[model samples]
Target: MTTASDDQKLASWRAFLLTYNTIMRRMEQEMQDEQDLPLTWYDILAHLDSAHRGALRMQELAESVLLSRSGLTRLVDRMERAGLVERHPCEEDRRGTYAVITNRGEETLFQAMPGHINSINQHFLQYLDVFDAQALLRVLTKVLEGERPAEGSQAEVIEGDQ
Candidate 1:
């Protein structure tokens, strides 16, 4: 039988999942209505736009966008067909491939930015005060860092790091 603490933790997890889903759905609808862009496509474009030379290796892009390799491959194929991105063979490694954002992709990203920011502000950020935002960020960062493997930790490791 689950104890009271376990029950409370489960409830909290469920609440977090529900809130995440609700916010994502609202943001997706807002983007679809206002910008005609899906959140997933925007996420991929945003990552590419921020990367050096507006490009990233396929594996890195998959990790950045939290998609499986096969899933990312299919999505990239679609984006390429849509004229939003292009695939370039890596000069360093013949086997490696890079996804480079096209001029059209950059234009689309710029066009979608305002609506995305507005949706975020309206659906999420408006609810947070400075302190709440900071606390939430800190807690989420800690959780994410903790989830990383010690061998390949993403956060910096100090002398006394756990």
Candidate 2:
């Protein structure tokens, strides 16, 4: 037994899900084809390249990449093994660790930028007017600021909050 309201909500949710899935799949494919990098890895490198001193505290890196801490640690482990990034002790804080992009990581991002820009333009920017893009930024910011699970997700780690 389904009501019209339920059907409408379902439709709306489906639209959101499909949008996310399609964009991620296309972005991943484009990055792989042009850069030999996964989108997630590129995101990490991009964040580092734009960061202060091309490095960030581990917790900060995880939050910036929108990954749970453990997830980020695993990602970093893989990147470290690939020679794209390295982790070192934080100078100011003995308990803290920093993720620093290696020279290889910088080169990887440089190689990826043109393809990334083209993909972004084709799949994202060209579809939106400037006004819409600004509005979308605001909307996404609001969503990011929203509350998370009180207990946090299982995959989440209780490290320093970002």
Candidate 3:
């Protein structure tokens, strides 16, 4: 009962998954070998480092990193143990907490940035020309627009439940 359009969509989805997994694996390996950093840890550090005042509320950080709130909490716990980040209780909201990048986290991110950029350039960006990059940006932006959670939707509910 599948139509031609369904077949095309399936193929595109599979292709995207394959490319994403391949590129991420290569990048992860390169990062581990060159800087002894895991991509997830690097991602967390990068997000925290880029946030205003080098911090973000736990729920916001979870959303930014595409992690479930519980997953983010566990990851933050691990990072805190490593002296990479710290949790600060929010003054305005007693129930809320912020993740703040530490000096060690900043230093680690600075160390890993070169390898990360090189991995992107070598594995991904080099495959695109300017026009292709623009087209990709447009396509991805459109896709993300649809995927983003609605205001006060399940995402918010999940954050509150956590």
Candidate 4:
């Protein structure tokens, strides 16, 4: 039995997914057109830059960049060829490997970051107001963490976190 609330939830879910895809596609296009950089590469490099020693273990990198291990391996290989990243053995676990960001990678990320930020702000953040942004942050955080916020936590979600 589908209630009005249930229908609304389904619509909300679809909206969230559609909006996410639209934003990502636009960002991807912007990155490629303006910076001549693939968004996936930019994402991987950005994650690595913030990681300890500008590197992450293969599995960790895959998880951080939301890629399958094999997919990440292929991309890393291409990046290595482009002198943007390199792979090295993990001393702690011989079976593990780390993907280290090269100097070129850091340089590329710095160059691309400014334009990417502008694109994000223009395409997505521009639509959100202050309290709406705050409320969204709270909601997304809860959803991502798979945990409900505390009692009265809803009250703390301001209208403008975006």
- lDDT by residue (1-162, candidate 2, tens digit) is 999999997896798689879988999998988778999999999989988889999999998889999999999999999999999998799999999999999999999988888888887789899899777666555454455545444223322322
Q: Rate the local accuracy (lDDT) of all candidates.
A: 0.89, 0.85, 0.88, 0.89
Q: After superposition, which runs of candidate 2 have C-alpha atoms over 4 Å from their true positions?
A: 1-10, 145-162
TM-score of candidate 3 to 2 decimals: 0.87
Q: Per-residue lDDT tens digits of candidate 4, residues 53-111?
A: 99899999997788999999999999999999999999999999999999999999999
Model 2 pairs whose backbones collide: none
lDDT of 3 by residue, 1-162 (tens): 999999998998999899999999999999989988789889999989988999999999998788999999999999999999999999999999999999999999999998898899999999999999878766665665567645434334333432
In candidate 1, which residue ranges exceed 4 Å CA deviation? 151-162
Model 1, position 3, has a per-residue lDDT of 100
Backbone clashes, candidate 4? 10
Q: After superposition, how far is residue 70 of candidate 1 from its true place, in Å?
A: 0.7
Query: Relative to the unseen true structure, what is the Cα RMSD of model 1?
Result: 4.3
Clashes of each: 0, 0, 0, 10
Q: Is candidate 1 or candidate 3 better by lDDT?
A: 1
- In candidate 4, where is summed lDDT lowest over 10 consecutive residues? 153-162
